[model samples]
Target: MKDEAFDPVRKLVAPGTTVIWRNTGSADHVVDSVQFHDTADQWQFRTQTLRSGDSVVYAFDQEGIYEYYCGLQGEEMCGVILVGDVSLSNSLPCE
Candidate 1:
């Protein structure tokens, strides 16, 4: 998803796969980690601020549900990542 407020924020993909986060929004946004508070740590893990039209690719090596949000000066837009299995797990019911 490009916009931070993009609906249906959760997406499922296979494990060891590469996913792209495109900054189609008009403002600056960050695909930050929910764990570490340091921006450098985010950058170290390939999660960082993405300007308008820019994008970042992250490879979900592990299998689990990942929660993330926009680390910017705007609304608190959050999203979830379901890795490894395309089918809905108990944590995230199917729509």
Candidate 2:
């Protein structure tokens, strides 16, 4: 259950779209807000420890860039989500 690399780092969705974070990795991960540094407003969402098969979903209602990390260094698991009319992404597969 490990495909942490060689995939889309993050996804941008439109407002009202639900973004799901599915952890298929063998290792446990904390899907928190890139360390929550000062940018409290930016850290609008987070997830509990997600192990293999575990998942989290977030519905975007605002337009902005949301950054996230896997709470692990070296691995440098970082991603960015741009919400808005950014080409009307449908990859989220959620309403």
Candidate 3:
């Protein structure tokens, strides 16, 4: 991920896929999970403050719409992960 934005603001993957995010910027960045929406797929996850060249890996094991943002940048630098076929009503909104 870059300082201003994630390379791809959205992603579609299988349930077992492992996502690896790298900090390729000149500053720090982090990925933090958004609040849950009362769904079975909601799980807490976050990465430590990532310095330049640092990376984080997360494995999504359920089918759900997972929303997250850069902890350092908040909503201004956010993204969504769509695991399998998820119901729109089952996830928190992200943009």
TM-score, per-candidate, Cα-based: 0.67, 0.69, 0.82
Q: Give the TM-score of candidate 1.
A: 0.67
Global lDDT of each model? 0.60, 0.58, 0.78
CA shift at 46, candidate 1, in angstroms? 6.3
After TM-score superposition, the amount by which residue 20's alpha carbon in candidate 3 deviates from its true location, in angstroms, is 0.3
Which ranges of candidate 2 are over 4 A from the true structure? 1-6, 35-41, 73-75, 86-95
Give candidate 3's error at residue 31 in angstroms: 0.8
- Tens digit of lDDT per residue, candidate 3, span 8-27? 87788999999999999987
**Which sequence of candidate numbers ranks them by TM-score, best first?**
3, 2, 1
Number of the predicted model whose TM-score against the real structure is largest: 3
Candidate 1: where are CA atoms >4 Å away?
1-4, 35-46, 73-75, 86-95
RMSD of 1: 6.3
lDDT of 1 by residue, 16-64 (tens): 9897888777877776555322211122343567888888888888776
Better of 1 and 3 by TM-score: 3
Instruction: Report the candidate with higher lDDT, 1 versus 3.
Output: 3
